[model samples]
Target chain A: MTQSLPSASGTPNPCIELSNVSKSYGLVPALSNLSFAIPEGGRYALLGPNGAGKSTTLKLLIGSLRPDSGRVSILGSPPDSRAAKAEVGYLPEDALPYRMLSVRENLEYIGSLRAVGDLKNRVDYLLDALDLREYERSNVGRLSRGNTQKLAIALAIVHSPKVLLLDEPLNYLDIPTQEKVIAMLESLQGTHLVSTHIMSIAGRLTDSVVMISKGTILWKGAIDELKRMGSPDEPIEKIVARMMTGAI
Target chain B: MLFRVLKFVLRTRFSRPFLGFILLMIFYSIVISRAIPPTGISVIISYYIVGIVAFFLAMSLATGGVMVMKSDRDFLFTLPLSSRDLSIAIFFSQFIAYGVTVLLLFAYLSQAFSSALLLVDLVALALTLTSLGTIAPSMTTKGRVSASVLLALWTSSALLKFPFTPGSAFSGSVVYGTATLVVLAAATVTIAFRNLPHVELDMVKSMVRSSSSEIKAPNSYVGKSPVSAIYFMNLSNMSLAGRFNMAGTARYVSKRVKSTWVAAIASAGAAAYVAFILIAYGAVHFSAAPLPAQIIANVILGFLAFAFSQSAITYERIWLSLTSLPPATYFRNLIAAKVLSLMLILAPFAVADAALAYLGYAGALASMVVVAVVIPGFFVLEVCWAAFTAPIQVKGDDMLMPAQFNLRQMAAAVPLVAVMGIAASASGVLDIALIGGLAIWVVSASLAVSGGFWNSVVSRLTESGFV
Candidate 1:
């Protein structure tokens, strides 16, 4: 059965939607009848423990993987459709851009492909904005992991996509870069779904949560609602862990 | 403890198929040795043996050395065993891994040598070869290339009748050759043993040093459209030679150079080849054309094409590329870029073939057509076929373990083998080769530009876990 969350801002159409979506790797199911939607300009975290189908859900939303049994869409269009693909940007977990290409080349190439207006200017903006200006000429293979993550983040939003899906966006980032990324993501005016296991990243970057466990949605609501579920001095992580393990 | 560790290393390291293949090769060698007459082996065979040995030595320096699986670092190295004992086990493992080729390569010479001293020579030769492989990982790229060049010169000197060369025994200087082998083997083994325990450190240092120093300026995308950006990127930055192993193991490859340089170097080589052909057979009066030379040239070009095809998409982050453009538009442009880069190399050779044909060289016309038309077509077909037949997600970086062997890798060779067969057959006949070449070009070009064809390829790649 499909499970659709109430729109946070009550927009009729979601920018990203997956309904009754189930995916399996060989005989092992990664997503089971999973359904979720984020309304236009809604910000949410797809939160779960390791191997709880967080990455799989993101891949499906990005149209890189097909759902075995349900529908996946970006802005009412199929995820792989030209319209949907153009509007969505993705940063996979542990993202690796072209190793032989330099930092600026990666940004410029993807920028060109996305048909960004004045690609050079856009690439310059990204390079400066992400603190990648110093390393623009360096090969991606030689960059530190944190810098690579910065380049990847720059790539995901290079076209100023209408919807962005990032898996472990903050995985390799240092604290300063993390704050910059969180600030940048917060300032963008589009739907954002960040898939991460860290509750602090979820709380800082998104306004709501979609908690999943064992391939199914366990809970969904505003962050305030999630916070109220805990007693005074309770870490949000404890409340989330309780729900994930069914101790709620 | 030493024996127990050695037994465990051997048992865990070698797969059943690997052991089976080695046994089968040994049995085959023995049968051949028994069948050949003592004097029937040609002297020319010695030249081939020298060449093969040089090639193996150079290749070991290029992409191989002692292999320590990640498992070894994670678990085995943690044990409280003696470093000397562990090194000995690893040294023996490296010996078996790298020495088998030399053993089989020389096995057929067993009947000719006939003396008890032949056993001594074979053992020494294997050790010399194994030592070279074992010492390679510790050397810098410049050092490896220098050593390889020196080895090439040494082997070539054998063809010039250097009395103490490794190939000297096959060429009938058994005493000098045996002496050389024993002395060389002992020196190399000493160096190899000294380097064995530090293989991990050397590999990391080499990888980091190589990556840091070899940066090229990013190509500009200022005026280029999206598809052409992809084309130029693939054209300017590409890897021509790489190592692929099975079981999702990482790939190690030669450094990436501008594909223009690869094509330029190839064209320069083709020019040299043309000069050789013209000089070998008088330019004015060419008789029954050089079928063997033409076939060899085509096979080499085909190999380059295959190499480019395999590495073409290895750098592609499908999530990025596919999202930027439609799959059809993206792949079509990607294939076009690779095909055009290949043409830069093939065009020079085709011109050379045309000059030969105009001079009335037999079969030169067919060879020219095949080079100019058929090969690029075959490259397109190969890229498309490989997406479905043996699609493996490319390993992300060089800092991973060596690739494993699997039967599926063999399937990737089918197209290259077929093209080689066609090239061989075409070398003798003009009409059939021309017609076949034309048909292939038409079909391949049509498929390359077809949106539907690319969609199917994208579907297949997605299903295969390439994303």
Candidate 2:
């Protein structure tokens, strides 16, 4: 994968940033003063257990939900702002596409909305890369969970957005397709924050990891540094579990 | 034991609301009965018999299918009870619910019933309830196709009435009703014992197949053009399109007016041609031409315009998928789209009327003016009513599920219809100019009210987490 310098040092500043953002539903807090930042061209993983605010964080970044306190900015503006949304692409957890639409129709429809350049060619490339060539005419409702995930991923990246927020991007995929998707996502030139529990997915798709628990950040650093914290030959999954549940 | 079963039934979240709603309906019927004369004794008896029969038929159709075909059947069949015991339990539970409803209705309309008739009613209700419970399990199957076939058979049997009328066929009633109830009960018990296990296994297999298949990769396709620019524009307009664009507004208004003009013109042209034929042929005495004919033309034009206005907004439910979009964007586009669509649907008819007037069809021209001037006003009133009172969710089978309606929502629709009717009536006595001026005022007022209504409703729905 090609490497690019962190854009935060430049005059335009970072592509996405969150400073102590907190959100809650009634008595249950979803995100508790969680903070993170991704500069332009940064590839990072957001690792946490279920209900650890992984989905909530992505929703905040995508402007689907507003933070109860603190701040979240995308490309230096509020997440839903035209300029911010224009540069951002998001795939929600268990993302559901328009069920009535066929695969090709969904791609083209979203492409038109985003005003992507050479829409047809871009859609074709994504379709082939994702290996969704045979069920193009099928309604999305009829597609399997794995295929639905593929279509959702395609939709998120259709605009070739500058800031991408993906929740469980490789969910429901077989091992081989997961590998293919990691490579495909790595090839894109943009800032990416992928939320997942799988350490291997984090390691392959991103260089850095941000571990969170109980809606707060537990650790943030390189994947290599996280591995070094564990004893030699210790599985990364155990390490992640320890960090998430605060066992260590 | 009965109370325990009732408690179990009520414990289900769906059942409580359903039962409560039915009770409320029964209460409302009682209130209405006080105002109208009590239906005669014969009619009351007939009503009870029909209600009992319908209740049994409903139970047999709904529960029988669920018992035989559903996965829940396994749990039910495995319970420590004999088939006869289970059938009796099911029968009484359904019977009690139906019986209570009838008792409430009779209490409210007490003046209509005699002691002998009430006894017969009770007997019929008991027989029907038990019969349905017995029959339901036999007719239903695990598969949808089989269930449908069973339903068709049940429906045909219910519709096939006996030769004796309610009061006339005493002997036939006794024989037919008793035979129907006994046969249904026997068939249900037989079927319940035989089909229960096979259906349970089939259900398990189907569930497993569905879940396993959900993880497979879908086949893809290539070489298709993207969706049209217009489709995207419509989607954006419905979902994310910001406050009004001047270009979009002008295009919409022009389109609306052009179509309405076309309709108006077409009506006028047809009317003028008929008038010319009447004049040329001297088919009838001119003095004999009824004045009501002119009024009829005016009413037709008025109704056409009213239809145009109502349909403009109603069409959005199907054409635009507004329900899924962001509320502010959806409302804005809805207002603009309806305004345009109405103009398109009604403007031609108005223009056609004016053209015919120019061609010496005075009556037709007059009707066209009534439509042109009255329609837009009606459109605004209807739109406002719909904006405030029309339920946000589209009517479908799912909507039939329990829902609450507020008093304010129920009242919101009243004024729109009333005001339009009053305005149309007033148009008859007032000078044409005065009526026209009033029409414009009503339309403008309705439009403003509608805009505010949309904003309030949208905000509330969003805040409530309904959308």
Candidate 3:
């Protein structure tokens, strides 16, 4: 019953695909001739160093940017199409909730628009799960950074989207909250594409890796496969550092 | 301690320009005094003191008066400076800077420094200003004043009334006023010095999270269908717009406006303007009201409209969340909603004024119809222009870009002027309505085509990292 995808393994048609897609801002090129795909329900991490076009790639996938050339599709339609938008839940790096809205209000507004069935129950569940009940009525502006991050997470998953694109999903959260978020995210159903420089986050959240550097996919495969690419006794991080720096 | 404070203040160069400006004005006053009549001294001195106080108050408010105190506290606290020196340093710097400014202003009234009592009063006034400026940032009040023109206007309005002047120098009112200022100055300075270690940052953000969270806002195509009740429920503050379903946009904006009380004041001012028109035309001797009053009323309305519409253009952070909704639907509703709120705020007043004044109900209806044609029509074009030009900077680190050259605004103004020209040339209300209807078609068509244009601009804005 496995779906076919147009990736390196040649599974069924990919849930997400970029075909020779390139994007740039002014003269500063972000992605060049970049192509990758993820089969339906694939859990992959987008790995790169700083300035490696990781953010730009996620933005393109979310239809926040149009590729300068070539094509990008999510769930078989254009990334910006209504179908794609409905299914995609994104947590941008350092995402901010609406400062003026109270915590419960923010959750309700997004949840209602997402048109989740029994939205009140779902919103209530998220509120309890995130330990946000204490400050539910307080404006997001008054919340501490960690609480704001929690609210943002709640907003992202409000729709129970089928495709989750997270950039540093655990950012600004304390250790206990991080663990809770990890567990909560693990429980969701989707093709999860997490972009992070932190290997621990990647290792825990995803089984497959799409290692990119200089806006191009350098290596991509199972996490175990990525580990084996290093020397016999070498640590995985050193291997990633080498690959990112072109020392591999 | 005095020398050290002076040296430190001088090294900062903060006071150099202020001192220099006061000196230059003083020199001008000295030269001009010989030709000045003594009779105007009372008026001139009154204006001078009030002007100087307002100039500094507005500036202090704008800067939050935090930079100097923060810099000094951080710099000198680690050094061997005592709290006394710190307070004195802060107070003296403030006192001397403002004292010199007032003295120079007073010079504009008289050829010399006036009297010893006047000098002391000036010192008290300057000290009062310094204290007021210092304590303001601690209140951590919310005032989103980014517009320079409005700031200047607010500052100048301080001269509208003054209780005491040099004319009343020996009067009891002058003594009481001076005493009150002195007491206030003393209390604020003491409190500020006590709480020098703690200062709150002015971090007031937008109270309106969004204009609307509706999945669909009505447009010419899909909007032809009836709206659901859920659509109205999502509106943050305002009531449902009957039939048109513009409530979501109006409510969100109205709520945001309520949060920022400046909008409320502007609206109230508009109401007062309406009343004045009613009173003048209906109750007074005049056949028609003065041109200045109408012009001023319109200016206030224009200001409110601009202020009310600012959110539509400056939705940088909100843009990310709004992307989930259909762009064309949201923006169209947004433009319509922005203009609707302005129309709601202002049109009633204009209509009332027209009916109550010499023009009567026909003129009122005519004006209302013309406004219906013009306000939303022009605002759609203007909002699109403003959206591309103005980028709301999210707090921390990033600096807001100065207002950009608004080509779309200039382009939009052409049709507005054309409509007004037609109104001027038209013989009757019917003629104006006919011309307005023609303009509406053009504006509606532009709004329809503007979807692609807005998408392009938003994409560019996103790429530029404004959000």
Candidate 4:
């Protein structure tokens, strides 16, 4: 029953690390003795079924939730430490910005807090890049869900953080916006860990996958390696499902 | 079928702690009836009752909607029950929802009225409250506001010694007042029942109309540093009326008006209140001091501060705020900004206090200190205390949903109430009020500024699922 995970990446240094981490919400275990790492600049997906602790892992790395046991670090610093927080950008699942603030204000407020240089220019750049210029003055409460998602994405990368942690980043986005976001995320130079249930999203956004089930690692490897587990024509989803359910 | 649905709804919607709160209120009412002399009920108390009822009626009309959860929308609305039966069930649900306020209002006053008359008035008030709340959704916003204003004017007629007004029964016009309320309650309940089935459709219409209306551009915080941005944004963007607890501690973004407007309105209200004090005690009872006015103003300010402070962090997204700066730095600035915003609202009252002092009221100087320095300082402690205890995460929009109250949430409110009690007791004494308020402010400021304290607070907040 010892399922092996390949070494995190070809690169040597880990920008994000979780060592023997275990977490729970009351009696329900989220992650038990879960250990993993993404090398510096590694782009990887934390793939899992619902309740497989994907979000918890991300929360732990972002320092919103502490593990019941073991260690979590970002860039070799404690995740909650200012140094690590400075280096990491995060997008929570179903994220809502300040309802009272306009889109432009939200960006500028957070940008200024993060000490982004020439923040007004940075905010303008983000508005234009994300096609949010038309609605930059719109209150976040009034934006359509897709535009809100776009704003959330813009907020995540507003400071050009060195490590991005995105949970279901494509959620509520249109196909075109998803493509735009994917391209935007790909163009950014940093390590990325995307937590998602969609296999296609994993394949598209990241080269490698860390599959988890019931709060433990089920398998971890490059998506190509995962695909090779089945016949060439097998849908990546079917392959992922089989592995997730222990049918493979 | 109606009975079945009512039973199901109550069982599902009423938490055990809320039931406990109701039971406790009943017990406290019994104690109050035994301890307090009922001789204090007089003509002035009757006018106060009219004001209280009018306030609740306006509130019910302004914020009313059927309490529908996503689950209820999916299942309860789609049920096969007859429309009449379903409507009755929803009406009863709304009654229970509004009954908490009724219970709180009547808990101490139950000894004043005869049991039979008390029962009649209680039933009448509860029925009117629930009926207006239920009927509100079917009316347009303009219609609702106009109706509320007209009704308020009519209600205030009772102050002129009008017969059969809702407050007239309490004002010593027993038979006619009772008759009027009974008829009004019957008519409103019937209308509410008839309108209940159309709530979903009306809600849709109202939402569409609201969304399609022109949205005014909000003020930009464009080149300001983070601290100033937090300060000004919290000041200008937030509304005293917009903050409500029904939706897991979220604020209504649509209700926001400029802080200048809020300040102006508040000043006018403060002036009116001062006028009321001068008219009642100064002009009418020339021998009596305005001690009650001073106490009421201070206590009211404290209560409003507590209410505003609840949303200080409830609407915050940790990923955005905390990750941008260290927790201590972010929250210290956040609390300071909120305190400053509260102080802006307090400025008018502070001016009112000074005016009161200039007019030679004995305790007005003490009241001024409480308003200017004490409450704003208490505001800082209140915000940090809320973050420490009962930091509820606000998810997506659920403005129409009823708040799921629990004992823990009730516990979180107790300390503030206790502080208000202290202020009420010591408001007449300047040295005690000033020293006590400053002591609280110093302790709160020390805790707020400490990096270690914030680290622990952030940990607790995350553990409580504030993310």
**What would the per-residue lDDT of candidate 3 be over residues B1-467, giving only the tens digit for each residue?**
76786567544524344345445777886767666655533554555545555545444434323224334445656677665665666555545433445555455544332444555555555555555545555543345144223443543444553334322232224564455556655775686676544533211212122233222222111111112212332232332111000100111122332312443554576567666755665544333333335433433344344444444544334324444655565566555555555565655555554544444522334444444454445455555655555444333211221111133322322443544444333213546655665675576547545767666766765765644
- Candidate 1 residue-wise lDDT at A222: 95
- DockQ measured for candidate 4: 0.47
Q: How do the residues B1-467 of candidate 1 rate in per-residue lDDT, one tens digit apiece?
A: 99998987776666555556667888998888878777644665677666665666555555446657667777888989888888889877766677765677455767555655677777887787677777877877788888888876775677778878766665667789778878888998999889877767422235433665336556887667887788887778664534333111224454667776877887788888788877877654667656667887987787778776766654568878987887778888888888887887898888888887887887788888778777888888877767656665553432433223344543665777878777777765787678768777787778777877766666556556564
Worst 10 residues of 3 chain B by lDDT: B242-251
Query: Which residue pairs in candidate 4 collide?
Result: none
What interface RMSD do all candidates show, one decimal each?
2.2, 10.0, 8.8, 2.6
Which 10 consecutive residues of model 4 chain B have the lowest summed lDDT?
B245-254
RMSD of each: 4.1, 11.9, 9.5, 4.3
Local distance difference test, per candidate? 0.75, 0.53, 0.58, 0.76
Task: Provide the global lDDT of candidate 3 against the true structure.
Answer: 0.58
* Each prediction's TM-score versus the true structure: 0.90, 0.59, 0.68, 0.92
The order by descending TM-score is 4, 1, 3, 2
Q: Please report the interface RMSD of model 3 to 1 decimal.
A: 8.8
Prediction 1: B-chain TM-score: 0.83
**Candidate 3 Cα outliers beyond 4 Å, as residue runs:** A1-10, B1-134, B140-235, B238-271, B280-286, B313-320, B357-379, B395-449
lDDT of 2 by residue, A1-248 (tens): 12223456565466678899998877888889898877777789998888788877876676556788999988778765556666778876666665445677667766664557787789888899999877677656568889888988888888787788887789998989888988889888889999987788888888988888889989999888988989989998888888877788
Better of 2 and 3 by DockQ: 3
Candidate 3 has an fnat equal to 0.08
